[model samples]
Target chain A: GESVGLHLPTLSVQEGDNSIINCAYSNSASDYFIWYKQESGKGPQFIIDIRSNMDKRQGQRVTVLLNKTVKHLSLQIAATQPGDSAVYFCAERFNNAGNMLTFGGGTRLMVKP
Target chain B: GAGVSQSPSNKVTEKGKDVELRCDPISGHTALYWYRQRLGQGLEFLIYFQGNSAPDKSGLPSDRFSAERTGESVSTLTIQRTQQEDSAVYLCASSNRVGGNQPQHFGDGTRLSIL
Candidate 1:
C-alpha cells in the first residue's frame, strides 16, 4: 500500500513571496522523488527531483527537500510569480519497481499579483 | 528536437464505443508509460513498456483496456466498450531507460470523454 499525499490542497501566496509545498509518502523504500508542475491545458512538467541518498536537490528556481525519517518531502519556490501558479505534484519511484511512478494528490499553488 | 506526442488532442464518444489513443515517444527512448488523470486528480499509472520485454500491465484497470507498442517507438492504447468512468486524460510519457532515477518526459495527453 504505497501512497504519496500532500499536506495542503491549495497554497496562496503573494507574487514576490516564497512558497513551500509539503508531501508525505508511505513507502520507505522509494529511492527517487520528483516534483512536477502542471498548468492549465498542459501536462505535468518536471521541476525537480531528489534521490534517497541525498537530503536535498536544487533546480533553477525550485528546491526539493527529502526527510526519510518522517517520510516527508517538500518543494520550496522562491520569488513566486504569476507564471509559477499551477498545480504541483509529488511522485515517488521505488528502486525495485523499474520506472513506474506513484503520484500524490496535487497541491494547487496560487500566486496573487 | 521534439518531445513525446499524443494524437487527437480531444475525443468524445458515446458509452460502449471503442477508442484508440496513440503515442509517439522520443526517438531512441526505450521506456514508455501510460497514465490516466481524472478531473482534479493526480496521474494514475496504467501500463509500461521497456524495449522488447513484455509490458507491465498490472496497472490496467480492466480487460477492456489494452495497449500495443511497435518496437520502442509508437504505442497505442485501446479501450473497448468504454464506460463513463473511463473518461479521463490519457497521458503518455517516455524515458531514455527504465532506470528508477531517469525522468520521464510527458505528452500533452489526449482528453477522452464518454457521453
Candidate 2:
C-alpha cells in the first residue's frame, strides 16, 4: 500500500542548465533514502543518499534534499551533461525493513546538447 | 577493486523451462541482494542475504522463485516453471555491511526473456 512515487515521467534539460527530479513517499517510517541512475543496458548506479534526520546532502555536482514533513525528496544536478541522461529513481528504506529498499517509478532525464 | 558481477548477460527461454541466475558480489562484502525490473519500471526487491543470517525472502513473488547464497560468496536465483510474466532484468547488488546506511553497489543485470 505504501509506496514511493515520482511527479514527472520525463524531464528535458539543456546541457548547461540545472536539473531537478522530485519524488514523494507515503511511508512515514522510512529512515534512509537513496538516488540511483540507470543508463540503457546497465544496472542502476548509486548517485547520492540522505538520512531522514538530514535535510540535504551534496555530492559532486549533485544534491539530495529531503522534506520529512511533506514526505518529499528531490535530486538536483548542476550543469547537466550528456552523460547525465538516464532514468533516475528514488528509493526509501524503512527502519524495520532490514535494508530492503522501496523504489519509486523512475524519471527519465534527457539532457539536450 | 571489481564491482558486482552477474553471469549470462542475456537469457532467452521458452515457457515452462527453468532458469538459474548467478551473482558474484564484490570481494569481502557481507550483504547481497536480488531485484527484478520489468520494462520501463523501477526495481522490485526479491531477496537479501546478510552474513550467516537466514535470508529475507519476503519480496519473492511466488513459490516458483527462490534464491540461495553461500556464506558471503556467490549467490544464485532459480525460477522453476517460468512463465511469460517472469521475463525481466534480474539485478544483483552487494554492500559492505548490513546497515541501511551502507551504499549498495550493483552490477549490470541479466536480461531474461520468456517466450
Report the number of the highest-DockQ candidate: 2
Q: What digit string (tens of lDDT, one per residue) describes model 2 on residues A1-113?
A: 11112343899999999999999987999999999998888888999999999999999999999999999999999999999998899999988777888899899998999
Per-residue lDDT tens digits of candidate 2, residues B20-115? 999999999999999998887888999999999999999999999999999999999999999999998999999988875987889999999999
Candidate 2 docking classification: acceptable
- Candidate 1, residues B1-115, lDDT tens digits: the string is 9999999888999999999999999999999999998888899999999999999999999999999999999999999999999998899999999985888889989989999
Runs in model 2 lying further than 4 Å from the true structure:
A1-8
lDDT over C-alpha atoms for residue A85 of model 1: 89
Candidate 2 pairs with clashing backbones: none
Clashing pairs in 1: none
Mark the regions of model 1 whose C-alpha exceeds 4 Å error after superposition.
A1-8
